[model samples]
Target: MKIGLLPLGRPTFDVPFAEEKLAAMLAALDATGHEIVGPRELLFDEAATRAAMAGLARAGIDQLLILQVTFTDASMAVAAAAGFDQPLSIWAVPEPRLGGRLRLNAFCGLNLASHALGLNGRAFSWLYADPGDDIAGDLKALLAGERPAGRLDAVPVATRSPDGARVAEALRGQKIARIGEHPVGFDTCAYTPEAVQALAGVSVDALALDDLFDTARTVPAEAAAEVRRAAEADVTGLDAVNQEELDRSLRLKAALETIRESGSYNAFAIRCWPETFTQYGGAVCGPTAMLGEGQVPCACEADVYGALTQLVLLEAAQAPVFLTDLVDMDAADNTGVVWHCGQAPISMRDDTAEATATVHTNRKQPLLYQFPLKPGPVTFLRISQAFGAPKMILSFGEMLRRPMAFTGTSGVVRFERPAGAVLADIIACGLEHHMALAYGDHRATLRAVAAELGLPLLEI
Candidate 1:
């Protein structure tokens, strides 16, 4: 098979050692006699990484190797990886502490890369071997389909107490408000309220963004001030945000709260997009997070089904559920990240990582929470209609300890199944990119929900 290589390097490292690692990796690839691809020099920045990835793809490589020469940026590899369809892998060299400042954080770099790639719904291979060694052999083993054993522990399992009828009885009169239309082309958001009602006994109250925005404008100044005060009290990086941006975000919170109150809605799924940024003066992630933590269950991007899923998971686990994109995964560790653009509750923030108020990554607008999620047992579930049928995908895993791989709320979860296999099921089943994430393993409850509703379940 023709193989591609991207030797990633960071600017902070002494260029020589990184260069040596690159040269050594290239030599190893040369030994394999596969059609090796990519620039002869290593990639150090976004532009170079993009160019190398495109160049290798143009050369028609069957597999791609992301060689972490020395603790490189996750964005460089992940951004490039986003466009590639070939099997992916990361090879990192270990850095030993020898009574000096660490020369390389290559392993940590790999860990972060895995988080970003896995959360994007991409599965990748990895090896922790230095260059000029048996990396080629390891690469060939991965290419030939060998997986190391890794499993999550203490995955919480709930006793199946209530049957479908009982659970549906509890949901019979519950109503959730969904504001505005789903994001464009997100057909996963297409749901008949009757379908939800028939299966789960919940109702969707469709509302308009205009109504919410209008209500927000009329909210008393004191109310908006209270929202701002509450938001600022626990967050650590409020000082970094501009005052106008901060107030704009608070106003969004006020508007949504007012709409929720007027309708007497139990939960909301909001269109937190172009309108929030273009029409309003800020992003709605912070406000959405606050609402979700408050048990209102606001689904970003106006996904009504996702919002409902959050409510269900909340009922099962009684914890806040985050709607995240499964961006990146690592085969070696059987782990990946559930990441989104800053909407996870502050309560989920890892104690070690400061809970900072930050802007959205792409739009560079204010009001998204930025922190690594605290680690423990976790569950991921997505409710979707695929192949003309409604199904709920459920999985249990351990929220492993790791630094947040990217901006926003991210949890590093190591799954019981092979990360690649889970990704394969996602594609085979045509699952949506959005997942409802809640703490603890509620697999048993989720299974009961699926069984009671006669919906299929993909246990990945």
Candidate 2:
């Protein structure tokens, strides 16, 4: 058998020992008759994993052997192995605790990788043993086509709620205006529009960013003024932006409103990135917030699935959904920061002096929002469809008032469980970074939503 051998490690561990582990595993595998092809160097981070995976892919190895020499973030492992359709085996090195700091969280890391792979509908076999002492039994079974048994089938239809029939019916006719494709190399932003349509009764329509920009530029000055006046009362970072930049922002919102009207679009997934900042000279985050207040969700990064998730929470809670990245976690306090590049809406902002208009921190351009979100009970709901099945990830937490951790809007969330547990689930499951956050404890409703959609709701 032609085996693609990926010896994995982490910079957090001893790199030299990891390298030794890789060399030893290669020698043992070579002596067993299978032809091995892969990077001679150990994969210690994202760049190495990408380059190595590409090379192994080109080599056309029949099966993948991910030999974990030490603990690495689950993201690193999935980064290289995301699209691998071949049989996979993860050989985790048993850690010998030498009475110091934990040398390697090998099993924990492997556990995470497995959950992430499961999210993508890839089942993998795992062995916690010394690669140097492996018998032929396990290898033989794999050779004879014994595949990993963890099938990420749809989650059982959840117990129907009092509003179950109505919610499902409403979700069935949902439509999202996708304004552009995902940004370059953002694998998490990738989704199968068709699969979402088939599984959740959601349809994504292709729309052009340029068209929105054009319409926005032509919008009447008075209309833009109304938006600016409202922004002035609550937005804070306007001093950094020019009048023209602010005007462009209002125009963009006008343009989006026009598009929403023309297409009867119920929601939006926008490509708010280099183009929004470079060409338009503004960010769409504040406008997205405005739309959310009006019950029209706009997910940044043109993440269609994210928009869909927002729509789910919006309708269910009758409140705004803030799409954000789980940027930081305070293990001691069991809290994490939910943040995005100022894309959150004003309604979600905390009632503090910081609430108001903003510019892009790095670009120093006008039109992004700046504020911290209000502290309250919040629920997280997000989804991804890879390997042809949609998987849902969710959790609940209390939003805390914390200083701005990054540019734009942010919220400090204290999970129901410890931050470490939540972090582990997120890392191990390889869940997408963006989640639709809404205030209030709606676990029951979200659970019903998952059951109605027939997608597995894997809580973080």
Best by TM-score: 2
**Least accurate 10 contiguous residues by lDDT in model 2:** 95-104
Give a tens-digit lDDT track for model 2, residues 1-460. 8988777776656677667767776776777688889876777767777788888889998988888777554675566566587877776665332222234445545655665565555667665555565546655565445635344333555577866455667888778898877765445666777877887788889888887778888889888887777677657656656877778876787788888999888999899877887887777777886777778988877888888888888877888788877655556557776767677877788886367666665456667776778888998988765343577777899988776655577777889999867765564455665789888988788778777777777776
lDDT of 1 by residue, 426-452 (tens): 544546567888888777777776666
Candidates in order have lDDT scores of 0.72, 0.72
Per-residue error for 316 in candidate 2, Å, reads 0.7
Per-prediction TM-score: 0.67, 0.70
Off by over 4 Å in 1: 1-160, 163-166
